[model samples]
Target: MSPARLIGLLAALLVAVAGLGYLASLTLLAPAEIDVSQQQAYVAAPVPAEAAAPVAPAGEPVGVPVVDAGWLATNAEASGVPEPALRAYATAQLRVDKSCSLGWTTLAGIGWVESQHGTIGDRVLQADGHSSSRILGPALDGSGSFAAIPATPESTMWHGNDRWDHAVGPMQFIPTTWDIWGSDGDGDGVSDPNDLDDAAYAAARYLCADGHDLTTGQGWADAIFSYNHAQTYVDAVHSAATAYAERTSR
Candidate 1:
């Protein structure tokens, strides 16, 4: 009814609106929650000695380790790895040098880091063990963040680039490395780096090379470091592997 009364009411309404705005800002600006259950330093898991029969003769098709489908499905769901990619990693553990003690989780860890099990960037790992689309890394022309690697005659075929070599496939194998580690994992007779099955098998063999026993801390770290040639990469893979292992262990 009075000017002073009207002014007092307006001031109270403005203060109330400012308080609501501050509360809304706090709600909108709050950081998202992060899961940190497996954030500790990497630890090696116990690996059992070879208890299965000897691998098939060199000339014969290598026998894939018989894995339970349900087990693969369960672990895949837990670790966010596709069923086919998870199968490739699990089978690789036994198909590789049995003495190396490589765990499936380690392979899954590398797959997660390299390309999220070949499903990164709108790419899906098909049931036939191939990525829906070809995944290639930046050119290694010794530019800002990449090593200067000239394309070799053979390297051009895998990546289709004549000037500079790029890492190809889900595992991101460079031309040089793929030449040494490429393998046929799906019994298709062709060793293709773009195929998740073949890439995973190749990665396993590379990690198991040089008599590295992946069950030991030093051995595991060295194997991962050799794959990426970076301590940071090794650490990330280790952390991913550790998380996968912990998730599937339960």
Candidate 2:
């Protein structure tokens, strides 16, 4: 073969090899670009798609916390939380079907705060969860100490005055607040806030409003804050509730 022809043939072979290498490089980069795009898509929508599962059915709870008669009897006397009222709290927890379950100890905590489980000021809880006497707060006459709500009297005899409204029952819910969430706990057709059963259920319903998730510590704090605006009140309720839960879980 001639020398020039040999050089030309070598050059032609080198070009073909370079062209093949470039084509391979493009092929390799194509999937990488696609993979990067797929990653970006994943970053945009990272959550899993889930079905709308039912939580509680017909005002009944899906996960009912176990508070047996034995447990109830022991805690009731010690904590002044009545058995019927405790049962009512647990039932409301399940019945309300909030995403976050309202612990019974939390109810006990509220009981401790408001009226000491209906044992405050010579008042006592009856067998059916009714207080021996009305548990009313000082008139919210918008004075130096209390909130001056412009609400009229729901019932003068029950609430004690005509000027302003006061809270009722062990939970310290004002009549207007109770009217929104009042329930018939004993199924006798009357929704009385003076009754612990009705009061407890109403309290739970009030707390569970706005789909507030009460599972995390923050969620619990937020719920309590909503119930009472004071930071001190929220802290006290959380502490009391935590203590009760720690005690009873053992």
Candidate 3:
């Protein structure tokens, strides 16, 4: 399907199930700017990535001063971030020209919370930022916990489950969330969920929606909260991000 139709479907679904208020932060880029694939919400993990790891996408600045690959490798355990993934965050931060400059550490923090930088329990991140094992969340079962989003297999050809939809990629975004916020971070035609570079960049865009500057306390808190609605999730991400910033971004 065309990118416009995909976006319209995503926005319309969210408005129908979640409410119009929840649509406030969904980014609305032109069809040309947005990724043009209905399958973009969850790029299948089975497809092998391009052998050469992705660099910064074309036409973006690569002038970020955040921690480099050497630093991440040296302090791997301390930051719990791998070199290539760290580099992706740094490059995305440098390239994204927004009022609320996203730092590499913030991505690291969220990465830590989401999937341990795609190293969850021995699943390692490959050069292309695709995790060895695709991490996913259980059905949003609504049980008064996560906002119940009906299984989207009917709408999404990406995730094939019939009874429930799983959150794809290292970042654990539901199909709806991925549909509305996903983007092609790697310059590849597809906005893959399993690719760390792709996932990290999409996440940066999502958090900074509405020009949210994450450098300040409230802004930091708000952005994290937007990523996940829970206060505990925000606190955990903030703590990790702060630790990373104190040592890296500063």
Candidate 4:
């Protein structure tokens, strides 16, 4: 072969090898441009404490503390019973009413158990004057009294006056019972069951009159029994009162 022809063949072969090497490099190498934003998005964000924690329902029992005599006394002192009528009643009762504090405490407990500390729906009379409804209006007796209407027929477990056909107010006292025994428990110049203080005081009066003593186990039990003859009723009131006392003390 001629020398020029041999050199031309070698150049062609070298060019072909170079082109193959370039093609292999292109096939083996990866692109440098990456989408870091998508990767970051894939990594979930941190959740807030509120979002992470389980939430409790409204008016549901959380943690109820134990209520003792000392706690009751402290609560009585702290409770704002400033009305002259209320103060007078408290003073008079304190002189001879040994279980006044206990009565108040138990009443508070009963209120909590009965109405979840008055957070339940408002009580109002029905248009018929004999019946009562929780949501509907036109209060009977023309007293503009805010009574607790039965949320359901089952709510009658507390106090349902078959005669009046309605559940009563703050303390869940039946209208019939209110008629017979309801008085200004707090001496706040009001005998309405919607008034928390009055209802608490009234409950105390009823329990005390029924021979319950907060200072003694028997008395407490008896008083609770008087409120409702059921053992479950007594247990619930006692438990709730004890819990409330403990929580308030804290």
TM-score, one value per model: 0.74, 0.68, 0.67, 0.45
Compared with the true structure, what per-residue lDDT tens digits does model 4 show for residues 1-250? 8665554454333322322332222222221221212100001112222211122344454221112333234444543222222222222233224533342334545654565444435433221111133311122222333333323343333334322224355455554455444454333344555555445545555655644445566666776776655666666666654543343333
Q: Which stretches of model 4 miss by more than 4 angstroms?
A: 1-96, 99-103, 121-164, 185-188
The total of clashing pairs for model 3 equals 0
- Candidate 3 TM-score to native: 0.67
lDDT by residue (tens digit), candidate 1, 212-244: 756567777888887766676776776677666
Judged by whole-model lDDT over C-alpha atoms, candidate 2 comes out at: 0.57
On TM-score, the leading prediction is 1
Candidate number with the higher lDDT (1 or 3): 1
lDDT of each: 0.68, 0.57, 0.59, 0.40
Where does the lowest 10-residue lDDT sum fall in candidate 1?
Answer: 39-48
Model 1 segments beyond 4 Å from truth?
Answer: 1-61
TM-score of the candidate numbered 4? 0.45
The sequence of per-residue lDDT tens digits that candidate 2 reaches over residues 1-250 is: 9665554455333322322332322212111101101100000111123221222324553333333455456655554456776666655554556455566666766776677677677777787777788777776776655676645656554587777777778777776666566676555556778888767777777676655556556666777777767666665665556555444433
lDDT of 4 at 166: 44
Ranking by lDDT: 1, 3, 2, 4
